[model samples]
Target: MATILVDLDGTLLPLDAWNPVFAEICKAIAERAGAPPDEVWRRAREKNLILMRRLDWRAFDWQQLFDAVAEELGAGRAPSVLEVLDKHLPRFRPTDGALEALRELRAMGHRVEIATNGHASYQLPVIRRLGLDEIVDGVRTSDAYRCPKTCPQYFQDADLMVGDNPIFDVYFPKRFGLLAIFYGDWEREAAEHSRRLAISIDAVRPDHVVKNLKELPDAVRRVLALR
Candidate 1:
């Protein structure tokens, strides 16, 4: 038996498919802000950068993100994060293969738990909507630890980590002495979200890279075998 921690956003509930929907959201927000969609993203990114700097990548609510776009664009009525999320709750779904992988891992007697940087306010809703609440062992967010998983010290007693972000999920957890299973879309993420790409993963071999979430069971087996 083993203890395992997995990420939420890209690892289990992949956001790649929601890119278009999110773009539509920005457009709607732009209309409300009376600004161009590009400007909306600029302000959002600007605020996001500052927030990341101040908080060092801890869990952040969607309200915070929406507030940034609204305040920076001087639009008080821009669509809120909850409004958009609630509207799309019916469409929310996790990777089917990943869900099965968790169940299989659990069947193998490994404790599968979610260790995410996403806030409970919204992440919990998705967890419930997707019925993930019944799948995994439990969920632990950054708010619970008072720091993001980017800090190597976050996994003081964990055995393993499964996530997408190479830096925060792979390198940091590995630095903390836990094995990391990298779950990400390398080709799709390259030349865009470099953070999700395994650029620095070469430095750490045998980190257990898997392109498909379905391969998680074998990866976990490999890591457990190593121990």
Candidate 2:
């Protein structure tokens, strides 16, 4: 049996309200700072690009970005990003077929783990709230390890990782010998990120790519075939 790692957010759970909730968070912080909402958002995005380039994916709750924006705006006190996320938590139900697919993978005797860049402070609540805690063998967070998936230790003894992020979940771990299942098509995203981040992302490809979670089990089967 192979050890497998699965991503959260767009992989295990659907992130339907991500944009609107984040926008509202920025607006609230901007209101407190007495700055234009666009200015606050721009600062957050700037900080996001910097963190992403450094492979720091631990702040999925956007606390780091929020703090940076508050500092730049001198907000003194910023609105709680987690509070906003909590209100919209219901919108983050499991992605269609995700639970079933995860069960299938585990039933095959694979050691399945929820490996995410998200901090446990926020991500775990959602996992448990939606009952995913009972489905997987364990959950792993970059915040817990103090490092992202780029670290070799994170993938130690793991045969594969399935996630939606082209860079963090796929490209970064592929070099470490983990087969990959990218949950979506990422050609345009890869090219755009290559230019936007000023990094060479050419020739990055996962062992399998599935646009639907229902296809995930078969994708895993194909990936395991390579082993």
Candidate 3:
């Protein structure tokens, strides 16, 4: 039985539209608090990257971070920040090919799971909304494990998981002795960063490199063949 763990944001969904939706949500929140939208966006982006890199997802909730940022901007908002965030959940859209690709992979008898970063309050709805709940056999969100993909322990349970970082992202599955796939799209800046950092997307030498979900089933088969 080959288990395949998949990524959520950029891997299963197209981030081009999602990024702007996120920006719009931040703008809305900033406007409500009478803060500069661009400044709020910049600060939030910086903080999020810092948090992810530091693997601090478990230490803070989105509401706490938002409130702190709001306070920094002289707003001193409260729980309403979370409510405003909830309103924007419907904005996310999975890639046009995601559902079809997932269905095909499932049909091939591979156990598919979602190994992603983010809290359940925010991540679960996105998964359900995208119909991922129907195709994936399980989900492993950072909130569930109290650690992000950047933490090797988080991937320890995945049968197979796709990620950009061979070191941290691919660590769990590899450590567990499961096949790991490196999902790399050179067209995107983040994928380019993964490449430049020599993060071992290929160096850790994933079982395969898939540019998109459409290529995933074949990659799984190739991995199985090697076994």
- Supply the TM-score for candidate 1: 0.85
Compared with the true structure, all predictions reach lDDT values of: 0.73, 0.82, 0.67
Which predicted model would earn the best lDDT?
A: 2
Task: Work out the TM-score per prediction.
Answer: 0.85, 0.91, 0.80
Clashing pairs in 3: 5-160, 202-205
Native-to-model Cα distance after best TM-score fit, residue 56 in candidate 2, in Å: 3.2
Which runs of model 3 end up more than 4 angstroms from their true locations? 32-34, 59-61, 78-91, 164-168, 171-176, 186-203
Between candidates 1 and 3, which one is better according to lDDT?
1
Better of 1 and 2 by lDDT: 2
Clash number for each model: 0, 0, 2
Model 2 TM-score relative to the real fold: 0.91
Itemize residue pairs with steric clashes in candidate 1.
none
Model 3 residue 219 CA deviation in Å: 0.8
Off by over 4 Å in 1: 17-21, 53-55, 185-202
Model 2, 1-227: lDDT tens digits are 98899999778887664676788878888888888888888888888787767777643548877877787787765667678778877767788898999899889889899998878887887898778999899998888788877789888889999998777788878989889888876786667667765767677788888899999888888889978
Cα lDDT tens digits, model 3, 93-149, are: 787567887888889887788777767776677788777998888888777778776
